[model samples]
Target chain A: MATCCGGLKLDPAVREDARRRLLSVRGHVDAVLRMLENDRVYCVDVLKQVKAVDGALAKVGNLVLQSHLKQHVVTAHERGDEDQILGELMEILKYR
Target chain B: MATCCGGLKLDPAVREDARRRLLSVRGHVDAVLRMLENDRVYCVDVLKQVKAVDGALAKVGNLVLQSHLKQHVVTAHERGDEDQILGELMEILKYR
Candidate 1:
């Protein structure tokens, strides 16, 4: 589903949401770093802040994965391009 | 300063810390998904969980980056391998 601006598969609402999520994560990261450097933070407190950042990252990853599955995977399956998906995912796993 | 563990520069303590951070993030991710699926969760609640996950991920990334800089980047600069470091980082950025 091409939008008026471009050929991105995600809807405008989703795109905006994703952007906001990324920005929020960036803010959280900066805040955590500042707290670590500028404040006499306890170890457990720092860990808690780190935990929050990771949770945000995971949620963003989930959202993007869901969007990809709906927009790309389903289309790929419909077109019978199972091998492409498999290869791409496998390559990414290998990167890790 | 290579350690006894096959020339890795990071101390065992750091390795353990990184592993614990990763595990904690995984737990948070699971909890968030569970809440999303099984609970009548509020949007703000879910977003907060997501934010935590992102912050955790950022912390992990920062830890790894700091360790690598102290171990690898500084060593590379000492050994006159600036080009390798630049190329590798550029390749990763290109992947994104």
Candidate 2:
């Protein structure tokens, strides 16, 4: 298990899953670009694609957040980093 | 002016701007993938980047929506496509 910042762990499987999803998202973005450049794409259709990308990104974020909560938040007090963990959680939420 | 579905117009400049933003987003997603593969990135840090991508996508969606509203929705009755325009708007909202 590799440690990230604050010595928190992110499961390798979870990281790999996130990477795969992001790659797909990158490709999806490219497809949207092609639609914009080549096709006389409808505004509603373009909006649908943009929303799909947004939804995909949200899922990736959730995967990371879930890993963090499972691995770090659960054991914060034992590791004596509760405040730091709490603050990090708050930071992520603020953006959402 | 080119017409999209329902003969709605999307401003050329707005479409160009969206293309540029989506290109940036594609690159950003690549960067995040690199961070995951190489750096022992903190979960919170990754979340911030993901949120940034989401924000950028939202801005692009807004640009498209704005164009639709200005060019199509406002003139729906004149074009006799009010029902179609209203339905499309509702579809986009359902996703959000």
**DockQ top scorer:** 2
Chain B TM-scores of the candidates: 0.75, 0.88
lDDT of 1 by residue, A1-96 (tens): 012121224434444565566567666656654544422233333444555565566656567556656665667666676676556445433422
Model 1 alpha-carbon miss at residue A14, Å: 11
What is the alpha-carbon lDDT of model 2 when measured against the actual structure? 0.83
Task: Provide the TM-score, chain A, model 1.
Answer: 0.74
Task: State the lDDT of candidate 2 residue by residue for B7-95, as single tens digits.
Answer: 55467788899999899988889888987885466777788889888998899999999997898789889988899889879988895
Q: Give per-residue CA lDDT, model 2, range A1-96, as digits (tens).
A: 223556665667888999999999998999899878844667888888899889999999999999989978898999999998898789889947
Poorest stretch of ten by lDDT in candidate 2 chain A: A1-10
Model 1: residues with Cα > 4 Å off, grouped in runs: A1-96, B1-11, B90-96
Residues forming the 10-long window of minimal summed lDDT in candidate 2 chain B: B1-10
What candidate 1 keeps of the native contacts, as a fraction, is: 0.07
